[model samples]
Target: MNQVSSSNASLLGATFMLGAGITFAIINVITPIVTWQMGVPSTAVVFWQYVIATVFALPLIWRIGFGALKTRHPVAHEVRAFLSALGVQFFAFGFASGVPVWQMVALSMTGPFFIIAGATIFLGERLTVQRLGATIAGFAGALLVSQIGSEQFTWASILPVLAAACWGTVSVITKYLTRDEAPESLTLYMLVLITPNHFLIGLILGIAVAILPAGALPASLATGFDFMLPGGDALVLILLLGLVTAAAQYFLSLAYKVADATYLQPFDDLKLPLNIIAGWLVLGQVPGILFWPGVLLIIGASLFIMRQDRGRLPTGRSPIPETA
Candidate 1:
């Protein structure tokens, strides 16, 4: 990034940033369609999505070879990979439970707060007053966005927030492991291990679904865990979902390669509005009036954090990796 002039690199990174935001927005909109409208189980949706995504990521893994697997923190890699897989599952389950696309995306923004909190407790990282205040506001914003006491709120609303926490914790561990492990090693470990985590978890869910009494669980919890892919157009949509997931990750990597993470923070925030618009246009999932207050706090707090960390964290070193 330092090799290129600031203006040129920032422009290039912004372009990729836009591309990534667009792709993830597409992902957000398509997910609920596949899980709810199409009747495919969320378990199967997450499983196959990662499998197809791995297929898209194969070329990079091949280029890097098994050498990328060499790491000083194998256990940490496994834990992070598993948590990332779990995060994807929780996000899928949110859609399956009918959380509107916009709301889910909004809740996902709480990740950085979790990362900061986790870093402070687990990594002994400093928690500045500004960061602590931002973290509190971020969670407060999440609570407002969640609309806990409103008739619209459901237990499902927690899933996206949980997903964010999972991914954020993954980022925390990545911060620890990256002290000695290469970034490529982390990516390689994720690509190789995440799908198995998905598969194993899916299998367990399938067994539980089959064996658990019919009325034992809530209606939402009782949704079948399907191992089979959906037929016809649903299959096509899931395939596209995987392809775009890889595309989003690729574009994010490109953006970080060319420009600083702080420089691209504003562009990253675009995902919230992009997903909101996509939900409104594609699914008529308009966010309620309360959504604005929460979203504002989240974006504002994130921008404030980025400003504070400008020279400290540096490029390619942001704790919140979207891919994680």
Candidate 2:
């Protein structure tokens, strides 16, 4: 009976991971294709993306206890989480505007590094040497992808790095807040709280781009919200992307809730290959030899972390503290 249950759990974990990988890959490809092909401003595209994501998430929110956001001390943890989400929003838009899914997803592979830093600093956890080495290797790969060669480093290459850092922060923050809050409640707050924050960011960025001098906009930012709709096919793709986005967030929150950071961390490495494949299928992206090495570093680091969980928590549904 125990063996059967363990097998079942492993199957479920694989299913959840596959679902996450496919959804995220679809979103990454859809965002860029919609904005680039449809002639919609990047900001406008992002605005509609968030709007659609929120709408799609609504049914799930209602099915759960979303109204819990109205409870006392609502602003305490939720606000911080919302800010963390804003960083994710910026990364989403940034990738959509400038980078391909290959680079965006590749850079995002560095998230575990930020996770380790956040765990050590914010969650009072100790950092492992393996994690540190892996992070350094992953960052080095990022530097290469960004074209940060000896004498010519561009800001464009750096933005994705910042975006990955933000992603790591989101994971840590989610882990921290999910301690007392149920997964449904935490996801609910994230949806409701982040909606306004992202909306305001879109609005402000839109205004900034419009008012900025001609060269200023391109040199400093790529705005997406230009008050135009993508074509019919593009519109359809965006809607589908929204649905996928909603599901991904829900599953990710659930995973964080039901598992420890160390146990579940290895799964996040799956995104690297997923993105690589998406890039190949959608954009004819062919990664060079350097890409594989960097991916290996990220994956190796995640496995090391997972290996450390050998005896600390049970194999399935371990109630390890989410504070990290």
Candidate that would win on TM-score: 1
TM-scores for all predictions: 0.93, 0.81
Candidate 2 residue lDDT tens string, 106-218: 66666667878988899887777776776677677666655455443445545566766765676676666655655556556666666566567767777887787776765
User: Compared to the true structure, candidate 2 yields what TM-score?
Assistant: 0.81
Steric clash pairs (candidate 1)? none
lDDT of 2 at 195: 57
Q: Model 2 residue 250 lDDT?
A: 60
- Per-candidate Cα lDDT values, in order, are 0.82, 0.62
Task: Tell me the spans in candidate 2 whose CA falls farther than 4 Å from its real position.
Answer: 70-73, 76-81, 128-130, 145-147, 150-154, 210-214, 219-224, 253-264, 309-324
**What is the C-alpha lDDT profile of model 1 across 125-231, one tens digit per residue?**
89999999998988888888999899999999999999999998987887787677776776678778988999888777767878988887556557666678888
Q: Which ten residues in a row have the lowest lDDT in candidate 1?
A: 315-324
Model 1 — TM-score against the truth? Answer: 0.93
* For every candidate, C-alpha RMSD to the true structure in Å: 2.2, 4.5
